[model samples]
Target: MHDPGSSEHNNRIPKPLGEAFLSLLERDQRRMLRICTRLESIADGLPGSGKLRRTAREIAFLDRAFDRHMFIHEKFLFPLVRSLCDSRESVEPMLCQLEAEHATDQGLILEITAAYAGAIGSTPRAVGVPLCTLGYLLRAFFENFRRHAAWEKMLLHPVVKDQFISETPKHQHDAVLRYSIGAGRSGRWFPAVVG
Candidate 1:
């Protein structure tokens, strides 16, 4: 068995897949940061800022993106981790919490969307509750998502790396081949060329 502590086993998703996944996550983080920063600016000032409509569109788009991202994790990453984890107990609760966050995010997005619309149509006082709620949720969502990504990096990645490393040389090579061919990115199918 390969040692979990081995540096070679410190990266999950194989090299190519991991790199791609990290890039995607980083891009998503940038989006979240932009949303968070935009949200923060409104908290201190009146929503009369001309940016409400644009920011509303971005938040709406993020709502859909979050759903798709969560679906990807649920369909691919989390299952892989669950199958490979040394103990399901160690990872299950975290997965559950993260999944639950998706629902919470949906609700927050609704509130934010409504707030944006209200602020645009009428006075800030008319939507004070939603405005306040939106500001709070933005900070909460960004921080929680940042921490969630960190947990995957620190905890799940190590476990996945260790599991991948534990495979026989042939299997590791096959995994790389499969991953490189887009198996990890999406459920694409072709005969896996095995030598």
Candidate 2:
């Protein structure tokens, strides 16, 4: 129910960092949601086991994008958030919850992937799973992922935007640089995705 754009404090994220990293993460989340929508439609239209491979393929694709998505969160955003917060205890619970959800998401995807492979070239009853059952799992994965991503956008994004420390523009820039993405890491800003 929370709105990501609503900020209670006057503090603002540095334009460069916000535009380059935060906004892109949000964009990625939206992209994932679109994928979820597609997956939901696939689930709805599934008529037989023949389409289960397509569901698996789409889930596999989503898993790749999700890896990059979680990399940004675990490597950059969460660390910056922890640093900016007045008390680590306050934010730790939320961070832990997100991390836990990440694990659950990965587990579900893995199960779906394995099931897809196991069911290949086999009948639905032989695999002990009906087409409708796989469809149910696909729907569940996307729905759960949708809720998780939305929660992150609603709770975390606004916190990052408004919780930063700054007095003047110089100080703001310093703060931004200190917590900027890819700091003290490889020159590569992002992992390359081979299309």
Candidate 3:
């Protein structure tokens, strides 16, 4: 495969643009994992549906942060790499896989959310739906997503960054916005949750 950002290549992204974007995206992912891990630990022990309900609500509150983080990547980062990439053979498939994973992740989250909601509310057990299903879905999502995110960061990020840096940074338009939690703003950088 052609190396876009290698010293032997001309298509390398401007180092600052690629690294800057990659760093913040990584940060957002790490923070989100921390939150999710904490929530998982909360729900992992004991057998109380009430605890599940509370945990669901807590996770729901932070769902937007996760959605927004993915949105920015899908909407901005991947497209740039796709269009500018020289070795489409190598990276395009990966980007497509990433996008597909994004969709899969969305579906998994919805399933998890529904299962949690079912566990929380006074639903009919006569329908044969077990509350244990919720626990299963919750655990599945965390286990799966952790590996997926880690793969993206480890394998995909460097390649994308190299491609992004090869291009002249000024001409491209990325709708970059930070995800601030409180009295702050994302502005030109990636999103941040302050709270």
Candidate 4:
């Protein structure tokens, strides 16, 4: 096991893929934080009945951010980490847990969107539901993201660097860059690539 606190660990340089992945994660985290701040401000105003449309638009933006996170983890990050690990025994469980969390988050987003839409369509009863849902979802979203980011920065990143130095080829490094920086260019929006 790597000692996360040691000076050696602190001095270690991340592999290209690991660095790119961290950069993407950091960028998205900042973006989400900004969005959350705006949402909090909006929530403070009590968001009158007339503002349902705007609230719905904000919820849609949240959905987009959440979806981008899922794409990165499910499509790129998790797979690469799993492939490089010696045993799936431990990592698989964490991946499963994280994926389940993603599913729950997506479900909450759908619920909130539906409520927001209903409210916008003039059903006053539906308005409160989205506000309550967003409150819960935001808490879960931020907590999960914070924990995951710390774990990656403290544990997985160093391990990935060690593994990459030991096993990866030059072409694989280039491939990592392409996947991290170049994938999903046209209509598909990547949170990291977007802002």
Q: For this target, which candidate reaches the highest TM-score against the unseen true structure?
A: 2
Candidate 4 total steric clashes: 0
- Write down the TM-score of every candidate: 0.60, 0.72, 0.68, 0.61
lDDT of each: 0.60, 0.68, 0.63, 0.61
**In model 4, which range of ten residues has the least summed lDDT?**
186-195
Task: Rank candidates, lDDT, best first.
Answer: 2, 3, 4, 1
**Poorest stretch of ten by lDDT in candidate 1:** 186-195
- Name the TM-score of candidate 1: 0.60
Across 1-195, the per-residue lDDT of candidate 2 in tens digits comes to 755666843456556644455677778888889888877887778755336556666877978988887887787677766655667688889998998988888887776665555446344534655566567777788989989988988888877767542234554455456555433222324322111
Off by over 4 Å in 4: 1-15, 49-54, 122-195
lDDT tens readout by residue for model 1, 16-116: 45445546655765666566566556554544542456566667776777776766566556665554455768878877876776667667766666666
Superior by TM-score: candidate 1 or candidate 2:
2
RMSD of model 1, in Å? 10.3
Tens-place lDDT per residue, model 4, 1-195, is: 789999998998765655566678668767766766656555555545325566667777989998897787788776665555657576777777767777876776676566555545556656445555455554555555556556655765565566556545664574454445543313232332321
Clashing pairs in 2: none
Off by over 4 Å in 3: 1-16, 49-54, 122-129, 164-195
Against the hidden true structure, what lDDT does model 1 obtain? 0.60
For candidate 3, lDDT tens digit of each residue in 132-158?
776676677777778878888887887
In candidate 3, clashing pairs total 13
lDDT of 3 at 24: 77
Residue 20 displacement in candidate 2 (angstroms): 2.3
